[model samples]
Target: MASSKSVLHIITELGRGGAEHMLYKLLSAMDGNLANHHVLSLGSGGPYAEKIRALGIPVHELGMRMGRPNPMLLLRLRGLVRKLNPDLVHGWMYHGILAARLAAQGRPVVAGIRHSIYKLSSEKFATRLVIRAVASLSPSLAALTYNAHLSLDQHRNIGFSSKKACVIPNGFDPDRLRPDPKVGARLRAELGVQPDVFVVLHAARFHPMKDHKGLLQAIARIKDRNMVFLLAGTQVDSGNPALSGIQDDRVYLLGERDDIADLMTAADCLVNSSWSEAFPNVLGEAMACGLPAIATDVGESAAVLGGTGLVVPPRDPEALAKALVQMKDMPQEQRIDLGKRARQRVIETFSLSKVASDYLASIKMFWMPTAGDGPKDVQEKEFLVHVRNRGVYQLAGRSGWGRADFAHHDRCGAPSWPR
Candidate 1:
């Protein structure tokens, strides 16, 4: 067999986030023999830096602070890339995507977009600038990956190419996240929750995008004292001034905990009120823990639910409250069946092994030479054709390349790639 290729991963930061967690898990599940992997964090490495290093992977940091743009860091990154001379560069988020292209120095780069682009007006000034910059640079990327289809469509509408892009939803570890009735019962008892009380969980960091206020209002509308709401995530504690609007005594704020699976098992269902997301990992985790969910129709939440639970419009407190009531009104047997189906969907389509394999395959597709290269397998040739034909430019009402672009061929009989 040929020797493994060198691949460098670049991310904006190593902070606690769904994208950061997914990267850590993907690296852990990927086969080292396939490629030599190294990570470069553009900002201070957070909790994940040590975790990734513990896996025997080299983790480098630029020590750049968040919300501060530094051009010199790009020069340093280029110098580091020149020293490493990786065969491929994989970028994680918006900042990393732009940095990867600039630092790769013509090497193949695969861009990873983890956040949804619902509206440019809704993003911060710095983020909007970065998004437009990446959109202009999107065509040059060898390939791009999105965590949700909604992100892909939203980006494509704003001049990003969808030809060489694909959506690979976040994966879950079923073995560690599965349901346990006994554990759930004990947790409920410890939390002073009665068996008859209906528990609703909202698991996401306290961010404006998360729309915690909307969820709180929805919970407030529900007068059912037996229905309890558990809020768990970063800064989601009793002291948060943002949560002071809550007047419900049944609401429990669990700042942040390591065991989210246990929290899921203890709840009858999960609730997401975020106005923006690419793919919410908590929903998948809840489903894996055999709990139904009621998520806003943001990003891929509804698709992720797959009808196993409920979906409401984002920022609509009335709709969210109604969905909560609907979930509470369900028969015990029916809810159990929905939770079972939720777990089955996750196991069948979004297992860790499966998503990791998809990432590996997409990386290899861009890394390998194609068309005019030496003899190629049918699969490789087909992939190139697909990539070539799918390269689209929709900005300014420009339709993609014409059939004439693919009419000509090289010796391999495959259509020549668009210039």
Candidate 2:
């Protein structure tokens, strides 16, 4: 067997967000026989660091100061790269991509674009310069969603060919998520919600892009008194202050709980009103837990849902309210069927195994054999000869054959094949 390859993955932080969660999933699902992995966080470690560390993968917290660029940070990163000497450097998100590309020099760098173009701009010229620099320096870049790939084209316009830029969707582990009736009951009871009350859940950080205000306005427009909205996610003070008022009897703002899977199960439906998204993981998680979703038709939402959920136009609370009402009146059997289809779609197309394989295949392609490395036919013959010499073919038939008596021995010695 060939020696295992080393890959270093760099990310902004180990935060509890979609990109961070996907990074953890990818690292955990990586084939140990193929590569040894290491992770570095350019920003401070958060909730995800512990879980990543628990996976026996080395996690480094670079203790980077937020909101300011330090030249020494790049030097430190380069030092890490020199010490680790990874065969490949995989960067996630913007800052991580910038730092990793600079540190990798001319080494193979895979930059992961996770968000939309609307989210890429910065008022600071330095940040934009860094982004452009990274885009120029990266030998190859990968987008987590098709929208992200489009976003890259619209914004940075990094002229890398299609072969150098590919789309690799996010994936989820169905087993890590399960529907817990007790969790739903406990959350409902804690919020003083009646047993019969219908809950619409929105689990996302209180960011301006998430459009929580629009969701709240839609819920306020609902005429039904029995309907409650469960808002669970981190609350950022930087976002619109008006969203803070959403905390009321009908709208419960549960800030950043670890039991999101349980909350998805507890809710009548999962709601997403994001102004933009590359590929929201909440929709996949909700579907995996057999919960129907209602989302704004933004950033591959419709594609991800695949008719398993309802979609409304962004920033339209009236339409959102109408959809909510429609979903509320939907037959229980039909809703369950939709949820099953959602889960099945995720299983078939977005499982962690599938995503990992796609990434591995892409990486292999990125490292294509150079001239004088031998042709495909020669490589195949060499591989077969190695297997045969190792006695792997003895089990192919009931009886083992002598080396000279093996079929196609002459073919192995042909000029087209490697010696």
Candidate 3:
């Protein structure tokens, strides 16, 4: 196997957001002898900071706050980038993407576009502005990657080029998250949930876009007393003022948890009430844990469910309530079978190892150009190669492989392939 290359990942924050959590999963999946990765966050360190350090991935914080533009942030980031000089700079989210572009300094930058724009109203004005700026500068990147197909088209429809876009769907680790009945039973007992109770999980931060209120409304409409809602994520606890108003005794609040896989395993079903999303990380995680999910028809969620669960339109509590009830009343054996199918689908198509490898395959070549590239548009790569005197060989862009530059040979009889 080829040796791992160094990559510096830049993100807006190390917070427990969808994008951040997905980045963590990617790092964890790609970690080992074959992956050398570091992290840089534009904002203060978050929950993932400790885990990242545990993985031996160095983390750098720039102390940039949202809703404000600090010019000094650009200089600091650039300084760090120049100092580290990684093989490629991979930026996550909009702000990170823009910073990566500015700090690339001739290195190939990979900008990750992780979300779809459902409406301008949902975004802060400053965030919207930064997104607009990133849109214009997006073409400067070696490749702009999107996890969801909807996001790629949503941006491309507004001016970004489809040609420059790459799709690498999020990956889940079955080894890390698999069905565990013992853990599930213990978790239920610890939570005081009855064995006969039907547990539904909603694992996401308390954001307006997550439609927490809508989910609450749907649950309120459900008359089944055996139904218990397990809300887990940032600010989903009793101390949160918004959630404190929820007086339903059946609702169990678990603020931020590290053992989401265990929670998913204990749950009878996973429900997503987000108004908009990129790829629905919670749904994917739940699937990896062998739990069926019910998600709104947003982003690529409906496609991801793959007939294993229910799908309802966003912002419709009645539909969601109906879906929840439908899932609850399912035959015991049938639900178990559905859960098995969900796990199988994720393992076959969205395993974290496979997804991590795919991401590496797509971005690895950006820094190291292989031999036999036809024509090189990038002038800096014009160094020549001699593969046993095969008529002055250069990397060729044949069949769309864009990095072929060879006019002079410094090392003759080197391997035909650029190591």
Candidate 4:
């Protein structure tokens, strides 16, 4: 019998990124009757892992080697599935999707494609081979934006069928992301920024794809002395060369931070300089916190921002700088109104509850087991772990035995397990 309440989510890591954050929100808001969730991280867990665990969700860290796929990882994952016996296995990102599909040979699987295929290109044959494998194995795939879905359709290598592919925009938990005024004040004061300064905030991973150089150049062009730029993201290497020797009192690099909501609220506008994105979560989060954004017209950024903020051409520093200046000179009342509109847009379109409900509905409609395909009784022996720390003396000098053996001896009656 199908429980319709069990799902296992597999991801490459639990780092602070858009896709990982989306998964966190979805898992947090999952319907109690419709889904019980577990997570498996291919890499070591990070800050978000503790948050998930606090929700009483089981999170397993595989600590697998990065950059290269190991066949042993698949075997370990398959064993994990057998032990957990979840009704559905959902994969996020390319590597996780491929591993999930391979492990779920006889089970239902759903893969999330979080980026546009147009953005995915590699000169290496091995990378292409892995992409082809993922395309071939995923039974159902989802894209986070309309443009992402369209991009998938355009790629010959990613043979995601139209009927099996769906677009589900990333959603946010507004309560967890509420802005803190005091924190914002302290942050500005610590940075020596004046109360009247116009701050432009850019929050993204410091990867080449984010086009941080373009953003820095744009900041250099903005002649306004009262305007300051705050860049918050992970520094990939020693430091970004584009940001080198460009130290002015106006530019600040606040590397990987925990209080993003405060930074977003403190800023006059959020800037996105990415060359590509599937659905920029920072854009949505900043908007939700009542901040207008200036993003390059790439990926689904324009779609996410809607008409609430200005959109510029990617890689054109001059155009971005011009937009920044325009926003800086705009009336305070109009800016506030624009921020209000942005928040309203997020509330209307991208609530976490709505996203979880949609995912549940889709599962029920497509992957629900039929009469002949009903789930079988999972053996308890497959999930047993020995308790070595017994308070008293050991029994019969044996450490442990499988549940089947215990059942045969009537140690545990009938060995019934949850379906």
Q: Per-residue lDDT for 41-160 in model 4, tens only? A: 999878778778887889998888667777887788899999998777888877778778777756667677676655346324665676777766543442211224234444434564
lDDT tens digits, residues 1-419, model 2? 52367888899999888889988888788776777788999987698898889888899888887578888988888998999988778888778887777788656666777777554463257666766666565434332222233344444444332323334567777777656678878977877887788889999987778998798788878889878888888973324466655445777767778888888877889999998887899988998888899999776677778789999999999999999998888988898898888888788767777777756654543344556655443333433443333211111121211122234333212111111
Give TM per candidate: 0.88, 0.82, 0.87, 0.82
Q: What is the C-alpha lDDT of each candidate?
A: 0.82, 0.71, 0.79, 0.69
Tally clashes: model 4: 0
lDDT of 3: 0.79
Off by over 4 Å in 3: 1-4, 31-35, 370-419
Clashing pairs in 1: none
C-alpha lDDT (0 to 100) for residue 318 of candidate 1: 98
Residue 416 CA displacement from its true place in model 4, Å: 47
What would the per-residue lDDT of candidate 3 be over residues 319-367, giving only the tens digit for each residue? 9999999999989898889889888888877788877876766665565
lDDT of 2: 0.71
For candidate 1, which ten residues in a row score worst on lDDT?
392-401
Native RMSD of candidate 3 (Å):
8.9
Per-residue lDDT for 1-419 in model 1, tens only?
A: 42468889999999889988999999999898888889999998688998999999999999888688788988999999999999889999999999899999978888999998778888889888888999999877877778765687788878887656656678888888899989889999999999999999999889999999999889888988889999999999978998866678889999887778898989999999999887899989998999999988887787778778888999999999999999999999999999999998888767888778767876765556656664234334535554444432111111111222445445423233333
Positional deviation of 202 in candidate 1, in angstroms? 0.4
Any residue pairs clashing in model 2, and if so which?
A: none
Evaluated at residue 410, the lDDT of candidate 3 is 30
User: Where does candidate 2 stray beyond 4 Å?
Assistant: 1-3, 119-127, 138-149, 152-163, 236-241, 365-419
